[model samples]
Target: MSSSDIFIGEIIGTAVLILLGGGVVAAVVLKRSKAQNAGWLAITFGWGFAVLTAVYMTGSLSGAHLNPAVTLGIAIKDGEWGNVPVYFAGQLLGAMIGAALVWVAYYGQFHAHLTDREIVGDPADKAIEGPHDTKNTAGPVLGVFSTGPEIRNVWQNLATEILGTLVLVLAVLTQGLNDSGKGLGVVGGLMVAFVVVSVGLSLGGPTGYAINPARDLGPRIVHALLPLPNKGGSDWGYAWIPVVGPLIGGALAAGIYNIAFA
Candidate 1:
């Protein structure tokens, strides 16, 4: 694909990816939404379908590598670096746009959720000022945009993210295999969607399975920037884990694929 096609395709594909994926979380978590309290199963399946839709929509234009981790893995596997920056830029921009769209779509729900005293506590009571309290760690609705761990253990969180992303990128790397060990198709996009759902169900407990750097970071940045009352910190301390771990996982998956599958 040409550079313009790749850039435009990634922007559109990733925008759709985050819009649906983050929109589901908002639907389940935000007040006044009919799907509120729909639970984790709903979230996992929503994300899977989000991936399916985005990939199918843009696969022809740019191969639909919507996630930066997937882009990194593919680049490493193919030894191509020239377009990596374009992919990264498009994904991040698209993610931010998607997140903003989610906020717009759920504007009333966000206001209701954040301002509800029962949900976010008294606005006048002041935020908890502790070294490791939940209030200071993350905003009330940050999960709609990014991932966070139930238990804050750095090593465990990092390892979980790395492992989840390793499985994801590795599966993506090998999904094109045919019966004759040659180039062919095997419902690759649908299989990748299943892999995402599998990763979310199996490994999401530890760190919410932020296997895609762009998916997490771009929206997290938006969360920080948006003007929402009582929206707490963006959890900058934990931010690097999602970004770094996925990149490391992508690189490691490339290495493993080169050794075992390539």
Candidate 2:
């Protein structure tokens, strides 16, 4: 595909991916929403469907490699680095756009959730911090925009993220073999979507399975930048784990694919 096509396709595809993926989290987490507390099953299925929709919509244009790890894995597999930057740019920008849209869509819900003294806790108990306070850990609404560890061990969190992303990129790389090497076509999208849901269900407990760098970083940045009251810290201290771990996982998946599957 041409650079322009790849860029535009990735932008639109990743935007839609994050819109639905992040939207699901907002629906479950935000107060006053009908889907509030719909639980993890809803989140897993919602993300799977998001992947299915985005892939089918943009597969023709850019193969819909909406995740940076997926793009890196494909680049390594195919030895095509020319378009990697374009894909990364588009995915990050698209992710931010989609996250912003989520806030827009859930404007009232966000206001209600954040302003709730019960949810944010008593202001008298703790001083109110800015939306992007770096010292504090994740805020109540941060989970909607990004992933965080339930238990914060550096090695454990890194390993979990790497493992989750390895499964994802490895599955993506080997998908062509299942369909006679045509890339992720119609059936492949559905298959990959299930893989995502499976990853979330099985391996997501530790660090929320941030298998995609752009998926985490882009929205975290948005969470920091957006004007949400009582929106607590962006948890910048743990930010690098999601980004670095996924890239390492993608590269590792490529190496394994080269050795075993190639």
What overall lDDT goes with each candidate model? 0.84, 0.84
lDDT of 2 by residue, 106-200 (tens): 99999998887676654332221333343432244888888888777889989999999999889888873234342467877888999999999
Q: What is the TM-score of each candidate against the true structure?
A: 0.91, 0.92
Give a tens-digit lDDT track for model 1, residues 1-262.
7889989988998999999999999999888899999998999999999988998888877778888888888878878889999999999999999999999999999998888767775442232222444454223388899888877788998999999999988988888423332111237778889999999999997788889999999999999899988788787888999999999998999899999988
Candidate 2: regions farther than 4 A off: 122-139, 176-183
Per-residue lDDT, model 1, residue 146, is 89
